[model samples]
Target: MNKELITDITKYQEFYPPNSLKAINNVLKWKNSEEELQGTIEALTFIVNQTLMKIIPEGRIVFCTMLERLDGRFVLLDEIQGVLNLNNNQMGKNIDELKNMG
Candidate 1:
């Protein structure tokens, strides 16, 4: 795995635990196999969505919006920004505006 990707995955360990990382790594090791990669991606996506929902419910929507974009499903970035807006009141004051700073 690339160092940056490994670092990113490691950052999620608190949420996913080491066992989840092992499973994901095993699956990604076989990523050269098309079927395996597809299955692994599906499983990982599920785990990610579930974990994020618990950690940050509003962020889950934003993450899913990006996931759709990653999957080439034609999601508009603005739509994701809108979801963030709706959830921002619960998040914090000034947070909604901060998101647009990107």
Candidate 2:
């Protein structure tokens, strides 16, 4: 399972770049399979979901639709990037600010 998570993180690193993706990959690689990676994925997922809740500020219905479109493989880094991009668009509202407010 740990190896699997490392593999996923590695993919994320490739999908992203020299950023948190690398940091996450490094962290996952260093920790023991029995220790760190055990619940790291779930924890990250939870954190991402919480952030999504802050961004949408609505019920799970819309969230589920978005997740389904992403095929259950959405990563926190990608979601944050999406929110940041949206915030930087014409609306010009930072997601971090909204998250902080919540």
Best by lDDT: 1
Displacement of residue 21 (Cα, Å) in model 2 is: 10
- lDDT per residue for candidate 1 within 1-99, as digits (tens), equals 222221123334554422334456566674345565566567877887675445354455345435634665666878655555554466443334335
Per model, how many backbone clashes are there? 0, 0
Candidate 1 Cα outliers beyond 4 Å, as residue runs? 1-32, 57-102
Error of model 2, residue 96, in angstroms: 20
Which ten residues in a row are the worst by lDDT in model 1?
A: 1-10
Q: Residues 19-87, candidate 2, lDDT per residue (tens digit)?
A: 234466576676445345546665676776566435432223223334444676756777645543453
Clashes of 1: 0
Candidate 1 lDDT for residue 98: 35
